[model samples]
Target: MKRIYLLLTTFSLLLLQACNSFFDQMPDDQLTLDLVFQSKQYSEEFLAHAYSYVRDEADRKGGVPFDPLSDDFDVPYSESPAYPLNIGNWNAASGNYNFWQDYYRGIRQATYFILHIDENRELQGMAGGPQLIKQYKAEARFLRAFFYFNLLRQYGPVILIGDEIIESDLDGNDPKMNLPRTPYDACVDYIVSELDLAATDLPLHFTAQSERDYGRATKIACMAVKSRLLLYAASPQFNGNTEYVDVVNPDGTPLFNTQYNATKWERAAKAAKDLIDLDILGLYKVAGDDGNIDPYRSYRDIFLTPWNNEVLFARKSSDLGWPYEKHTAPRPIGGWPSYSITQQLVDAYETASGKRIDEPGTDYVENGFSQADGTYTEAGTYMMYVNREPRFYVTVLYNGSYYPSRVNGDQRMEFFRTGSSGRDGARDYPHTGYIVGKNISPNSDVRNSQFISRPYVLYRYAEVLLSYVEALNESSPGHPDIATYLNAIRERAGLPGVPQSLGQSEMRERIRHERRIELAIENLRWSDTRRWKIADQTDGGEFWGMNTGAGTSLHDPAYYQRTVFERRVFRKEYYLFPIPQSEMDRNSNLVQNPGW
Candidate 1:
């Protein structure tokens, strides 16, 4: 892969532009790339720069909010970048959340680090010696592979630049600079192989003496990434889909495989099973006084607890401490409360009896108020929110929900027209009459000026388990392990095991529904809906919620009824994000996606 050295003047210009901050500040005598790589400290700094492009999952106000793009939530501000996309204003020219350029810049940084890190001799006499150099190079490899996975999932097939760091003095018209996009399956295989090689050199777990290295790449991180990548490759969007059969390069190279392959599912299942066989991780749990697992605390604390057994990958530092919590807090307690959940997500939660609200014997009531349920709600709580699953109580904040605050003396939230979190000005209310409860710490109080410091999880054991079952069902449906692992997830949530009578089709829908509830607001729903080829059915047309326009009191009938808040457009072309128009203009080898 390193033999093919192809770098264009366009790539050079972008590379120089992206590296100005790292390369320009020093005196001319010390600023050369060779001089920077010769020092051990500077080489470490460059490795850190390679990881600077990882998306902050806790970010809500800055980059694209993925939850709003799916059917799970609505961004109330018209100024949001996702608003144009939701209303059908998206195009190839649309620059909303364009990561194509950012990720390639990261790839170039990591590639340069991998190529030049061996030049530093100071590392040879250090604590870990030349083997430490090998480990550093492997970390760079993992980062490069991670960036390619993000690119492939969003833009489909992309140009794989491999391990070469070419420097050319020729004109910008060189044909080597204009390589065509690699085929999708080939890209998957290359990334998987890179991860496999990286896993060999990375530590399975960092020692307590090296506690500062908690969030760096590890052998398990590599395996976790491979599982997710193969699962996407085996999905309906990329596997045997006739929609992209005509998406070929200018020289007649097919960029997508149109033939269905059941073996891809088998490969995905094996990747997940390989990780599960390690036996080092399990679902994070907390026990009640009676020694039974407390489902509510277990689910709620997964995000708040740092470096727990449940987290396979996490970011140590982020800007989500107070601002993120403040946004989800009720406005009466000094919060913005504009980020709200959708009724579609509210309806997805099963009753405490492990049954859908519409299912028989669910005992679901939607019309009146109820006495305090002793947990999750208080006296006079709305009947619509009563007797729901523990995860629902942990994840959704509704009208009349009890909120605990050290400064506000434990108040109840109100979302009526004249209430605390109701429709006020443009930016202070929830348009859907609900607030996001997941990921916000229970101890955080905006009015008290207190926030919880915690790590943001990137991957966890539960997601890998879910992916394992999903892939196994597709490849070998009714395999006993499918029910065994699926039951593991269900039982942790305090629900009973799934019925063994369910066939493949019934089990498939069941797995998808569980994913929507378990992985909601974790930044996976947008891709999950797209890969399953069901975005048009789930994300199109009118969206409903509690009536935010009416309701002046706590029990207002008008406020309790479901009403349409926004209507969205989801076309077939929206399934694959368009290749940014600027990329096509800059490189002649690049072609626009269909219907962009």
Candidate 2:
């Protein structure tokens, strides 16, 4: 495990050198087989290359931001992938913003690394020779499995290329070169097995003494991935999905298993429990000097602080004025407004007392607007945004909200029309009339003297807890542990626990809403909806936004209503993203998903 300090600087140079191999018949700049095994530094460099694609969640620079595709947020700009996905303009070739080729290239590199690292003479007789080599091999395997998991989850059943790299001059006539799509369940099994191997060799945790080892594959990361992967395998969207009944291979065999497997729920529950029972991590609680826990600070800082105990896995971004801050921060304080929170997402958070607004016993009421076709009729004041969940205050920023701190002398976020920063204030404006508060760090604004970048949290303890509860409910309807885990999250968010009488069906809804609100803006909503096979119901609706267009001035109350933003179209066939035609064309054995 290499600390990610000045190495990322050299990694950029290595990437450039690797790119030089493309055109030159023989390029010294390339990461050749010889270059990797030269020393521990060089070997670790290659591992770092593989580590770059660990899917840390938010990468605006990567051209594929998944947050905008879901109903939680609306990306009004047409140039982004979000716009096309929202409008249903994407397809196998046309609307495709998928990561197939990049991830496959990573898989190839990882497989090649695993296959050759043992034979490196330099590594054989080094200071930490045997242990280092073993760790390297394990790291590479972890990466290989991780990349494969990413592919399988996105494209459903895909070919398991294994630890063999195709030579540049390989013969096309070889049957082994062109592999058929493996069964979806088989892919899951293979990935889980690889993770199991990885977990055995990896360390349980990284001490501050070895802080540079922070981002590398650890035992907990491997276990966490296994938990998530198994949960997906056990989900209704894949376990027994009738939607993919026709998703078959070129040889006419079903790709996805349509048979419901009850024991899979048990497997998922146990996997999540294994991670939790390790007891090394917890829902972050900010403690006062007097030892009182500040639930709000704890919940908010889980994202703000890097490598906090709550973070199961993360990628720390160099505070080099990263654009994630600039995008989510409003233009009133130098933000790009790339991701605007939706009205529906704002409504999803339970009241501070932990009751749904629509439920009978909640203090929060849905009162802003009334309409027939749309909700923005006779507009009311912004009072409805008040007294919601503690998480809500930390997640969504609206008309009268203030910044976490002063920036360039601005404190209150004046989002009303024609205010210092409003709809017409800058070129970058929130289309939904609400900014994403969750991703914006308190010190990330340009108004501050210095920037603070949080580790891009990929997996966390809260998600693990929710996964356990979900599996428990699916397997045992009224498991006693369900309320304990569910309320643990709620308690950390400054809310009460669940009601004792809550049934399985309502608890299922509770779990989904908890994920939506808890993992808000983490780019998990799209995947969650897909796995639950509820995209048609969850996504295919009229997207709503605060009606900031009804008046040119803040004096008019009509501008404060919930209005239709865009009518989304989610097809049942869209449950599985289409495998690119280019991939299918290249391999005769590769089968397209159920729908293109």
Model 1 TM: 0.93
Question: Which tens-of-lDDT digit does each residue in 503-554 have in candidate 1?
Answer: 9999999899988998888888999999999999999899988988788888
Q: Give the least accurate 10-residue stretch of model 2, judged by summed lDDT.
A: 18-27
* lDDT tens digits by residue: candidate 2, 1-596: 12222222234434322222211112223455655566565666666677665654664433445677777877767776667666777878764567787687678767767776777788788688878788878888888898899898788888887866666455665666668899999999999999999878887865421665676778888998999999999999988877778877778988888889999999999999999998778888898577866666777788777787888876644322455566666565666655678888987877766777788877875554322221211233355675677688788877666656544454555566665456664656677788877755666546553566445788899999999999999998888899999988887887788775799999998888888888888878888998987888878879888785555554456667778878988887678788887777777788887767
TM-scores of the candidates are 0.93, 0.90
Candidate 2: TM-score?
0.90
**CA lDDT, every model vs. true structure:** 0.81, 0.73
Q: Give the worst 10-residue stretch by lDDT in candidate 1.
A: 1-10
The per-candidate count of clashes, in order, stands at 0, 3
